[model samples]
Target: MSARHAASPGRRDEGRAQPAGGGDGEYTTYYGRPVVKAPPWEVDIPAYMFAGGLAAGSSLLAAGGDLTGRPALRRAGRLTAAGALGFSMVALIHDLGRPERFLNMLRTMKLTSPMSVGTWILSLYGGPAGLAAASEVARWAGLRRGPFRLLAALDRPAGVAAGLTAPPVAAYTAVLLADTATPSWHESYRELPFVFCGSAAAAAGGAAMILAPADQAGPARRLAVGGAVAEVAAEQRMERSMGLTAEPLHHGKAGKLMTAAKYLTAGGAALSLLAGRSRVAAVTAGAALLAGSACTRLGIFEAGIASAEDPKYTVVPQRERLRRGQPVRYEG
Candidate 1:
C-alpha cells in the first residue's frame, strides 16, 4: 500500500481510526477541523432577546396592575412593553438585512422551527400590547370622549390577552439558543429558560418602579426581588450541571460579563427593596437591573461562541460518548 493508504496495526476501524478512550484519555482530531459550527448571529440577536423578554414581562405586569387598581404602574408597564416590542421588531428586521426577507418568515409555519414559532408569537403579541398602551395614553391625556373611551374600555381585556402570551415570549429565546449545536448553550437548556424568565421579570419590574409612583410600585419591587432570587438560583444550578463544560463561562470575555451581571443583578435587587423612600435610589436600581439583564444575554451568547470556536470542546465530548458506546449523532 502507498504511504497515504498505509494503516497502523493498532487501529481496528476501516480508516484505522485512532482510539479515543474515555474518562481523561487523550483524543485526536482530523487535522484542525471544527466539529461544530459557530452561529453567525451578531450583537443584534442578544439585543432582540433582551428587548423581547422585557416586553413580555412588562405586559404581564401591566395586566397585574390593571387588576390591582394601580393606574400609574399599569400605564408605565404597558407603555414599556409596547415600546420594547416595537424596538425589538426593528432590531430583528435590521439584523435580517432586508425587510421583505424578514416578512418571508411569516409566509409559512414549521412546527420544528423555533424561529417560526417565535415570529408568530411576536406578531400576535404586538397588537394587544400596542392597543393597551395606546388606550392608557389616551386615558391619561384626557381623551376619553370618543374612540379613546372605546379603546380604554378594551384595555383590561387586551392587557389580559397579552399577558397570556408573555411567559412564552420571555422564554422561547432560551429554547432557540439551546436548540443549536453550541455546546455551552445546548448543555444548559435545562436551566436557561428559567434564567431568562427571571431576568425578564426583574427587567420589567425595575422599569415599572422607575416610572410608577412610589405608592403604586410595591408589586414591582416585590417582583424584582423574587426574580433576582430565581435568576441566581437557576444560574447556580446550571453551572453545577455543566461541570467542566462550563469553563467558558468563567475564564474569558464571557466570564467577565457574567460576573458583572451577577453582581449588578444582586445589588439592584437589594437596592430595589430599599428604594421606596428615595427616587434616586429607585432610578439607580432600575438602571442596574436593565444593565444586568443585558449582560446576562450577552454573556450567554459569548460563551456559546467561545465553546463553538474551540475544537477541543466538540471532540472531547463526542469521544467520551463514543467510548461509552453512546450515539454520536444528536436526535433533535
Candidate 2:
C-alpha cells in the first residue's frame, strides 16, 4: 500500500483506533480537519443583529417616554427604532440575497425552529415600530390636519405595541446563535440572551440621551446604567462558565473588542449619571454606550468564527464531554 494508505499494527488494538497518528492525545481531529463548520454569516448578519436589538430597545424607550410626558425622548426613541429596524431588515435581506427569501420564511412558523420564531418576531415588531416612527415625522412636519392624522393619532398605541414585542426581538437572535454548533455561542447560550437584551437597552438609551434634550433624558440615563450593568455582569459570568469554549473570547482580536466593550459600557453608565446636568456628558455617555453595544456584537461574532476555525476547540470539548459521560448530541 502507498504511504498514505499504509496501515500499522499499532493503529488499532481490540478493534479500536489508537491515539491519532504520532501526535499527543490532546489533539482529536484527524489531520486538523474541523469537526464542525463555522456559520456562513458575514458582516451583514452581525449588523442585522445589532440593528434589530437597537430597534427593540428604542421601542421600549419610546413607550416609556410617551407615558411619562417626555416628548423629545419619545420622538428620538421612535425615530431611532424605525430607522434601526429598517437598517436591520436591509442587512438581513442583503445577507439572504433577496427580499423574497425573507417573505417566504413567513409562510409558516415552526415553534421548534429558532429561525422561524425570529422571523415572526421581526415581522410582528416591524409594523407598529414603523407607524410610531412615522408619527414623529408627521409631528415634525406639522401634518396633523392632513392624511398623516391617522398615523399621528395611533402613535402612543403603536409605541406600546412595539414595546410589547421588543423583548423577543432583542433576545431571539441569541437563541438562534445558540441553536447552532459554533462552540463559543453554543456554550454561552444560557447567558447570551441576557447579554443581548441588556446591550440593546444600553444602545437605545444612549441614542435617546444623545438626541433628547438632556433635561428630559432621566429615564434614558437610568436605562443606560441598568443595561450596562446587566450586560457586563452577564458577559463576565458567561465567560467564566464556558471554560474551554471561551478561550477564543479572551485571547484574540475578539478578546480586545470584548474588553473595550466592558470598559465603555461601564464608563458610559457612570457618565450617564452626570448626563442629566451636562449636555457634553450626556453626548459622551451616549457615544460610549453605543460603541460598547456594537463592540459586544462584533466580539461575540468574531469569537464564534475563531472557535470554529480551530479544530482543537471543537474536538477537545466533545472529547472531554464524552470522557465525562455527558450527553453530546448536536442537531447539526
- Strongest candidate by lDDT: 2
**How accurate locally, in lDDT, is each candidate?**
0.83, 0.87
Write the residue-wise lDDT of candidate 2 on 1-332 in tens digits: 12221212335322222345644453333344455679899999889999999999999999999999999889999999999999999999999999999999999999999999999999999999999988889889888986787787798899999999999999999999998888899999999999999999999999999999987888999999999999999999999988888999887889999999999999999999999989999999999999999999999999999987765566557657878999664322
lDDT of 1 by residue, 14-42 (tens): 43224354233433334533446788889
In lDDT terms, how accurate is model 2?
0.87
The C-alpha stretches of model 1 lying farther than 4 A from their native spots are 1-31, 330-332
Cα TM-score per model: 0.89, 0.91
| Pairs with backbone N, CA or C atoms under 3 Å apart (clashes), candidate 1 | none
